[model samples]
Target: MELKLPEIPELSRQHRLAAQEQLDRKTKPVGSLGRLEELAVQLCAIQHKVPPDTARKRILVFAADHGITEEKVSAYPREVTAQMLANFAAGGAAINVLARLMGGELFVVDVGVAAEPVVGVKNRKVRWGTRNFAHEPAMTVEETLQALNVGIELAFEAAEDEVDILCLGEMGIGNTTAAAALLCLLTEAREEQVVGRGTGLTDAQLEHKRAIVARAVARHREWVKTPFEALCAVGGLEIAALVGSMIGAAASKIPVIVDGFIVTVAALVAYHLTPKARDALIFAHRSEELGHRYALELLEANPLLDLGMRLGEGSGAALASFLVEAAGRILREMATFAEAGVSEREEQDVT
Candidate 1:
C-alpha cells in the first residue's frame, strides 16, 4: 500500500504569543510559573489556541517482537512480547495500572508479535517478527510502509474520537538494542555512546549487546539513506508505527507525550521525517536508558520529569499527563491580576 502522510503545520506563533500575554496577566508575579508557563504556551501553539484543552487523553502501546532478540541482547525472552500483550488486554500491566489511575484509556496494538494471537488486542501485525538485522535488514521497505500506515490510521481514529492528548509507548524484547542501533545510525554516534544495559544486563551482556549493534550498523551502513530507510534497516515494527503515529498526531493537532528511550527513537524518526512534528510533541520525562538523553538532546527536548526511570510501556508518560493537565488548568482557571483585585507593580522604563 502507498502511504500518504498527513501534512503537519508549523506551530502558531500568534497563539503562543497570546498564551504568554495571558499568562503574564494572571494573578502572579511575571514568569512565576516558569516551566509550567512555557508548557502552556507550547500547548497553545500546538493547538492553535491560547489555552489548549487537555481533557481527553489516550495512550497507545504498540507491542511487537524483534528478531534481534535471537542475538541475546535482552535478558528476557522474545515470548514475553506476546505474553505482555495479553497482560495489557487483561489490564494487568504497569501501563494499565497507570493509565487507569491517570484516567486515560489504554490500547494494546499488536504490530508484529511473532506469536499466537492474543484476544482483545488490536491486530495490525505486519509480520510475525522483523528479520534479524545481524543477518539481514530488519524489515523490507514495503513491510515498513504497511506498519507505518497502520499507525496513521490509528491517529485518525483517535482524532475522530476527540482525543486531545496522545501518549506513545511500546513493548518488544531487544527493542533497546534496536533503539540504540537507530540512534547510532541517525546521529552517527559511536555504539558506546548509545548502547545501554537493557533489562538489567550484567557488564558482560552489555558488551555483547554493543557488539551486536555495531555489527548491524556496519552491515546496513550503506542502505540507511533516510529516516524511513534507517527504520527499515534497524528499527522494529512498533517503532515504525510510532513514527507514523507521531506524524499523524502532529497533523491532527494533538499533543503527543513521548515515553522513554525506545519511544524517543521513534520520535527522532518522526522529527527527522517532518521537522514540524516537534511542535506537537511533549517530552514526558527523561529515561535512565543509555542513549535517551542523547536522543532528547538531539531533539532539543526539555522533558517535564526525570525520576531515574528506565521502564517503557508508557508508564512515565501516563504519570506526566497530570502535569500537562495542570498546565492547561493554570492557563484557563487562574485569575487575572484585575480579576483578583491585586495591586500591580508600576511599569518602569529601561530607556
Candidate 2:
C-alpha cells in the first residue's frame, strides 16, 4: 500500500474530554483558563497521562551544506554553515542560547557540510556536503540513507535518555532555496509563493534566487509528481537528516516540535517517508519563510507562534515550549471547582 502521512498523536478523546471536564470544574468562570486548558488537554494526549510535564527537552540541530550555494541562492557563505556548527557546539549560536535559557540540551550533527568534520565535535556528517543540485541530483540514495541513519542514531541516543520532547533545527547556507524548491514539488505552491529572502537577500537577489529555484524545479518537474523523490532532487543533507530525526522521534514515541522552513521541510519529507511521524509532532510556528505556511497547511498543523520569524535555529520551537508547559501545568496542577470549594451551576447557565 502507498504510504500516508503520519497520524496525529493518538490523544484519548475520552481522556481529553475528562480533563476538560475537570478544567470546567476549576474555581473560575467557564473557559476562564483560556488557552491553558486547551494546552493541558493536548498535553494529556501526548504524554498518554492525565497530565503532562516536559521535564527534559532535547533540541537537535542538523548542520550541513547545500550544493545549491553554487547558484548564489543564499546571502551567507557555505563556510558559515561549518562555522555555525562550532558556534552551536560552543553554545554561542542562537539555538544554543535558547536551549540554555530553557534548560534544554543542544546536540549538533554534522550531516553533510562540505568541510572536513571539525575536531572535538560530534561526527555525524554523512559527507562533507551534497553535490550542487543545479547541475545534478543533490545526493545519491546511498548518501541519503547514510544521512537518515545518522539522524536515527542520534535520536536513539536521545530516546535512551528519555527525552520528553524533541525540537529539530538545521544550519546550512543556500538551504532555504532547497526548501522552497521542495515546497513547489511537494505542495500546490509556485515559485513566487514559496521563495523568501534567507538570511537577508536584496530584492534583486530574492528574485534571482526564486528564478534559480524555479529553474531547478522546472528541470526536475518529472520527479515532482511525488514528494520523497522531489526532496531527493533538491533537499540538503541537513534537511534530509532532519527528516530522519522526525521519523526516529515518532518511532520512539517522543513528541517532535518542528522548527521553521528548513526543519519543516525535513518534517514534510519524513512524513512522506513514514506517515506515522505526523502523529507525534507539534507545529512550532507559522514561520516567516514564504513557503512555511504552505508546508504547515499541507501537514494540517497549527503552530503555537507566528512571530514573523524566519530564523531557523529551533528557537521558534523553543518559544512554543512555553505554551506546552502551560498546558501541562493546567492539567497537572490546576485545582478543580470541587477541590477548591467553589460553586458551580448547570452547563446551560455557564455558557
Candidate 3:
C-alpha cells in the first residue's frame, strides 16, 4: 500500500518577518542571540504566529529489533531492545528521566520488538523483527508503508493533545547497522565513512559491521532509488516510524525535535520524502556517531547541543527541549528597547 502523504503546512513568511522585526526591537543588539534568534524565527514561522508557544511537548521512543543483531554487530545483545523499553516505561531510562525533567510527556511504541509485549509500551508491532538485510530486504514495501502510517497516526494523536513540539527517539538493537546501510545507499557514501562502533563494538566487530553494510548496499542498490525503497530494503521499523512522525508533524504545523544518529537517519528519510518537512525538524544534538555529522550536513541541520551524546531513545532530544522552550520564552518575555527605555545603537554600530 502506498502512503497517503499528508499536506505539510507551509512556513509562514509573514510570521517569519514579524519575528525578525520583534527580535531586532528587543533590548539586545540585532542578531546578538545568534542561532537562538534564528531558532525563534523558525519557530514562529513553523507555528504561523508572531511569537511561538512551545509549552506542550511529547517524546515518542520507538523500540524495535533488527535481524542484523544476529550478526553480532553491536556490543549489546538484541534482547536489550525490549529490556530498555521496559526501563523506559518504568521511568528508569535516561530518556524517561530527561523527558520528565524537560517537561515532555513520554510515549513508548513497540513497532517491532521481536519479543513479548512490555506492559506500558503501546504494541504496534509490524513484525517480530525485520528480515536480515545482509541477505535480503529488511522489510517488504507494505511493511515500510505500514510503519510510516503508524507514525503519522501517533503524530496526529499528539496534535490532538495540543502538543506544541514532538521529539523523536528510538531503541532498536543493531538498528545502527540498518541506518549505516541506508546512509551509504542514499548518500552514495563509502561504508567506512558512515559505519562506526555502535554500542561499543570492538575494532574487529566494527570492521565486520562495515563489511555487512557494504554487502547490504551492494545487494539492494536498485531499492535505493527512492526514500520508500531505501527504507524497505535497509531501514528498521523504528526508523520508518520516525520518518512518518516527522512528516506528520510538518503536516500538522508542529516542530519535531530529532534525537541523535538513528533518529537523524529517519529525518533524512522524511526530508527526502517531502523536502518541506525539513523546515519542521529541530535537530537536538550532534551525536558522537560518525554517520551523524554526514547526515546532518545532508539535511543542513545545526543541532542545539553537542555534549558527546550518542545515546538514542530521545534523551538528547528531551535535553534539548529545555533550549527550545527557552527560545519561546525568550522571544515572548524579553523586553523591547522601547519598553525598557534603553537607548538603541545604530544598526551598523551594534555589529
Q: What tens-digit string does per-residue lDDT give for candidate 3 at 1-351?
A: 777899898899999999999999999978998888888998999989878989999999888999988777899989999888888878898887787788888999999999999999999999998989998889998999889988999999988888999989999999889999999878879999899887988889899999888887998995567878899999999999999999988998898899999999998988888999999999999999989999999998889999998889898999888888888888999999999999998658555
Whole-model lDDT values for every prediction = 0.91, 0.79, 0.90
* Each candidate: RMSD: 1.5, 3.0, 1.9
Which runs of model 2 end up more than 4 angstroms from their true locations?
A: 1-11, 346-351
Candidate number achieving the greatest lDDT relative to the actual structure? 1
lDDT order of candidates, best first?
1, 3, 2
* lDDT string, candidate 1, 173-282, tens digits: 98999999989989779999999998889999999999999988998987678887899999999999999999999999899999999999899998888888888999
Q: All candidates' TM-scores?
A: 0.97, 0.91, 0.97
Q: On residues 1-351, what C-alpha lDDT tens digit does candidate 2 reach at each position?
A: 222323335545776787777777777787877776776776666656665657788888888888889888888888998788777777787887788788887877788888888764678877778777777778887787777777776777888998888888888888899889888887768899989998999999999998898788888886656666776788888887788778777766677788898888888888777776777788889887888888888888888888998888788988887777666766677777788786777657555
**Per-residue lDDT value at 184 in model 2:** 82
Backbone clash pairs in model 3 (N, Cα, C under 3 Å; residues 3+ apart or in different chains), count: 0
Q: How well does model 3 score by local distance difference test?
A: 0.90
Worst 10 residues of 1 by lDDT: 1-10
